[model samples]
Target: MPSCLTCIARKVKCDAPDSLSDCGNCRRLGEECRRHNPVPMVVSRQESKQFTRAGTKRRRSQISCLDCRKHKRKCNGELPCARCIRMKRECEYDTSHGKEGTFHHSYSVQAPVLSSIQTSPSQTSHTSSSAAGYQSGSVNSPYFQSDTSTQDLDPLAMFAKQCPLFPEKELMKSLVQQFFARIAPCRLFGFLHEPTFMMKIDQGYGGRFDEFLLLAAICAAATKVNHEANKQMWESGVEWARYVLQQLILDLNRISVTKLMTLVVLHEHEYRIGNQSSCFLITGLCTRYTHILQLNVEYDNDILCQNSSLTASEKESRRRLMWCCYVMDSFASSGVTHLQLIQENKIEIQLPMSDEHFLFERAIVTDLTPDTIDHRAYLVRLMSIRNRILNYVKRFDKDRDLWDPQSEYHSLLSSLQEWCNIIPENWNLNHTTIYARKSQGLLSPLIELWIFFHLCYLDLYRVVVPGLSPAMRPEIDAVQIAAPTDFLQSSQEACFNHAVKLTRLLEASIQHEKDGPLDDPNIIIGAHEAIRALVSYAKVASSRINDDTKQLLAELVDISVHHLRLTQKRIPTAILGLRRTVSIIKNSGLAYLNYTNLESDSDSDSSQERPGLEEQLNPLSQFSVAARGLSERHGKGTSSARVGSECSSSQKSMFDDDNLLSPGRDMFPTSLEGWLTSNQFGDFI
Candidate 1:
C-alpha cells in the first residue's frame, strides 16, 4: 500500500485499509484517491541498483516547465504541462544542456551598450582592496560597493524593463536638460549637481532604484513649467513620471542621497498640486532620513569618516540636501511651533557654496557662518530668522515682554531691519541685475529670497491689524495687556507698507516670466497674504483717504487679484485665496461691487454718504474710549515697573468688552481651530 497523491500533497496520513480502497483524508476532502506502486524491499543488489538507476532517470526526465517552476508547482512532464494548460500560460523550458527538445519561443537578447565597461578581474580585485581599506572607519563602504556592483548591471536596461511606460531615451534626455535649465536652479532642487547627474544619465543610472526615482521626479518638476508649444508632451510626461515614481516609492527598501533628492522633488510637486497634507508627511519622512544619514553634521567628521571614493561634489550635494530639508520643514510648518521638526541649534553643517563653485565641482570650505552673502545661504539665514518670529507670535497671548527693549520681539524686528540695511547693490531688482542672474541661472532663487524677506515682515506685523492674521486673531482680541496706541498704529502702517512691497515683487516676477522661468508655486501664498492685508486696509481707510491715495490702493488690489487669478491655472490652492478675497470685498458693503472691475462709479450715491462710512467700517472706532482710558491709566504711573502690573485687571475688562462687539469677527476668524475648519482655507489638510 502507498499513500494517495492528495494525502501526500497535503502532508496528511492516508488512513486507508488497503490500496484498493479510498483514503479517509481524500474522502473527507471529497477528492479521488490515487496512488503509485511501492518498491519492494527484498530485492537483490543488482536489481536494487537497476531500480535506483531507473528512478534517477525518470526523475531527470520530469523537469518542471518554466511557468510551473516560477510558481513552485509540480509538473506532469508533458509538452504543455497540466498547470500551464489549465492556466493558459505558454509552456517553455530551458534546453541549454540539450536534454529538453527546445524552448517554445526564440528571442534575440542584445547586451546593453554599457556592458562593455564591465570590470575585469584585476579591476574588481583592486576595488575590493580599496573598499576593504576603508571598512574599518567608514560607515558608507558597503553602500559604495553596492553602487559599483549595481552599475555593472546596466541601469538603463533595468529602468526600461521595470518601467515600460517611460518615454524614449532621446525625449528623456531633453526633459532632463529642460529640468536643469529651468527648475534645478531653484532652492528646492539645489541638491542635484547638474554635471554629476547628467554624466550619470549619459552613462547609466547604476541600476539603483533611487536614481531611477530621481529621474522621474526631475521630469515631473520640469513639466510644470508653462510651455504652450509642448503642452501635450508636458501632460504626458507629468502623468508618466508621476505613475513611475509612485510605483518606485512602494518598492523602496533602502535610503540613499539620491532617494532624499527624489523625496524633496516630490514634496515640491505635492505642494504645487495643493496636497499640503502629503507634503507635511513627506517632510517628516525626510527629517527622519536626514537624522539616519547624519546629514546635519559634516560627513568628513570623526563620526562619519566617509570613504575616499566619495567626491567633493558628492559631499557638497549632501550638504545642500541637508539645508533643503531644513527649508522644507520651515515652509511646511509655516510658523506653527508644534509642527516644526528641525531645530537651528542642532544643525552643524556648513552653508552651501556659490553656484559657480558647486557647478564646476570646486571644493571650497564654506564655514557654518558664511562671510560672503551667497543668495542660497542668505535664504537659509532668513528662514532661521522667520522661525524665531513665528514662534514669538505663536506665544503672544502669555508673553509679558511687550514694549521691552530686550524682548524677543524687539530682537526679531532688529534682525529684519538689519537684513534690509545690508542688502548688496548687486542683489537689487533692476533689469540689469535680473538679466545678469538669469544668464548665470540664479534669477529664480534670488527672487524667491527677496520675496521671503518681505513676507517675514508681513508675518511679524500683521498680528496688530485686524482681519490680517487669521491664526492669531483670537489671541489678538482676547489678550488683556493693552499695547500702546503709537505702537499699534506703527505696526498697522508697517503691515500695509510690506503688503504693498510684496505685491509689487510678485507682479514683477510674473512680468518677467518670459525672461526666465519662475516656477516656484509657493509665491502664491505670499500673494494671498498680501491681498488680505491690502483688502482689509482699503475697506477701512478708502473712504477717509484722498482721491489719489484711494486710486493707488485700488490699483494695488487689482494687481494682486490679477496675479492670484493667473496663478490659479497652475496651482489649485490659489482658487481658495481668490474666493476668500471676493467674499471679503463683497461683505464690506462698499460701492466697489465688481471684483473684476475695481474702478469707482462716478454717478453712485454712495459717495455722498462717505462721511459716516468710516465710522461704520472702522474696526477700532468703538474701542477708542477704552484705549484712551488705558493710555491715561498708564500715564498716571510714576515708575515704568508699575505700568504693566497696575493696568492688567482694567485692560482685561476692556478687551473682554471689545471682544463681544468686535465688527472684525465676521472678517476674520475668532479661533485657530475654527479658522482651519472654515471653508476659506479649510482644504489645507
Candidate 2:
C-alpha cells in the first residue's frame, strides 16, 4: 500500500514504505506528506513482499498503455491492479502464456493509471451507500435530534402500559429476565487490564468517530456497575460521573443530559473485562471529556488542525470520547474493579483515537405545557425509582420502614434523588432542561424506574422483613447517630406525594382514553389498565397487605408487562417495562438474602469468619447483643458523638457502626434527629 500522493504521481506501481509518514515515494515526490489514515499506524511490509516474491516471474510482459505500464514491468500479468480494472481504465489483464498456453507469473504489479486512481470512485466506496448502518450518520456521530411536542396523549394515559412495580417479590422475577434474556452469558461482562496483555496492542479500530460511540457506551456501563453495589459511595459515584461528563460536554464543545446517562451506562458494561483494547479506548475518552470540561473557556481550542474538515487534534479528541463509550459498555457487570486489575496483574490502558463526536440532541430536547397525563406519568417513574431506592435502604433499615437515613439505603436514596433531580420541577416537561422534562411525562418516570430496579440488583440485601432485627430497639438509644433529617425525609415525603398524585392522574387519563377507541393497539392498552395497576400501589401504601392488594399488584405488573411486550413502542417505554420485570426478579433475590440472615448460620466457623459486618449483624444474630448495647447506653449518661475515634478510622474493621451505639432508652430516638442515628457511621449514604 502506498500513500495516495505517492501512488498518484508515479508512472509505476508505487510501493510506498509501510509507514504513514515519510513513505519512500514521498521523498521522491519532494512534497510535504501525511498518513492516509490520519493516525500513525503500522503496516506489514515484510509479509507483503513475501507473497510477491513467492510467485514466479513472467518471461515476457504484454504491452499496455504508457500510463498503466511501468519500466521493467512484464506484461501477461495485468498492467494494473484489479482496482484499476473496475474503474474502466485501459490496462493489460493477461499474464504471459507458456508454449502449451500455461500462464506465466509475476511478483510485481504494473504501474497504475494516474488519472483513474486519483479521479475514479472505488467500488468499496460505492457499495457502502447501499448498506444500512454501515454508512449511517450516527455510526460515527454522537448527537441525535430532538423535538418539542405536546400534541400526543398525556403520559399518564399510558400508565397501564407500564408494568412490574411495587414490592420486592415481583421485582426480582422481572430483573432476571431482563439481564439474562437475549444476552450471552459471562461474555456480556468481563475485566481487562492492558498491562496484563501478552502482546503489543492494536491501536486502530476504524476512526476516532467509531471510538467515540464505543467510549460513550463504556462510560454508561461503568456507571451501571457502580450502581449495582450492595453499598456504594453514591455521592462520590454521582460526583465522579458528573465530573467526567461535565468535562466531556466542554471537551466536545457541547452538552446534553441524554448522552451523559448514555455514557454512564456504557462505561460500566461487563463485556470489557479482560479486554485490553477496550480499556485503552476509555482512557482516551476521559482525556477528551476532561479537556472540554476542565479547560477555561478562553483557552478552549476549537481548532486542532486546519487541513482536514475536522481538525486532527479534534478528530483524536472524538476518538477518545468514543473509546470511553466502548469501555463503559464493555465493563458493565464485568465484575472487574480497579482493585481487581491490580490483583490480576493487568496493564493500564489508554485510548488511541476514535475520530468520533458528541451528540445528545434527544435528552436535551424539551417542551413546555406537558398535559396532565404526562405530568402524572413522570411522577410515576420518579416515584417508582424512589421506591426502588427505598427498597435498598430498607435492606439496612433494621426497621421495615420505607428508608433509613443512616443505613446503606441512603446510598441508593441519594442516587435516586440525584437522578430524578435531573428532571425540572415544572408542569410542562418538553421544555424543561432536566431528563424528566424532555421525556413527555410518561416516558421519564418509566425509564427512571427501570434504572431504580437496576440499582436494587446491586445491593445484595435479602431482607423481606427488617423489623425482625433487634438492632432497631423498641425505642432508640441516645448513642446511635440518627440519619440526617433534611435529606431522606424530605426526599421520601416528596416522592410519596408525587407518586400518589401521579397514580391518580394516570387513572384519570386511562379512563379518558377508554372513553374512545383508537387505531394504535397501544391506545387500547392506554385504557384503565394503568389505573387499575396504580390502585394496587395505593393498597400497599395504606398497609392493606391482604390477598386482594397482593393480587392487584400482580395484576398491575402483569398488565404493564403485557402491554409493553405487545405494543410497538419506543426504547424508553421498553426500558421501563423491562426494568419493572427485572425489579420483580431482583426483589426475590433480596428476600433470599434476608431470609438467610434471619435463619441460623449452620457453621460456627462461618459465623466467626464473617468477612463483613453485614453478615455478622444480620437479623439472625443474637438479639441479646443489641439488648446489651441498648442497656449499655442507659449506663453512659453522656451521648456518643457521630464521628468515630481517630484510631478506629485508620484501622480496617468488619463493619464499623460506632455511630450506632445506644445512649439509653430514656433518650430514645423517635424521629431521626430526636432519637436513633448511627453515631460512628460517617455519611450513611
Task: Go through the candidates in order and give each one's C-alpha lDDT.
Answer: 0.59, 0.29
Q: Candidate 1, TM-score vs. the true structure?
A: 0.64
Cα lDDT of candidate 1 equals: 0.59
Which ranges in model 1 have alpha carbons more than 4 Å from their true place?
A: 1-154, 204-206, 227-231, 302-309, 367-373, 472-474, 478-481, 516-518, 540-544, 590-685
Candidate 1 minimal-lDDT segment of 10 residues: 134-143
lDDT of predicted model 2:
0.29
Model 1's number of clashes is 0
Return the top candidate by TM-score: 1
lDDT of 2 by residue, 602-654 (tens): 33123222222222232111221222223223222121212222324432221
- TM-score, model 2 to reference: 0.28
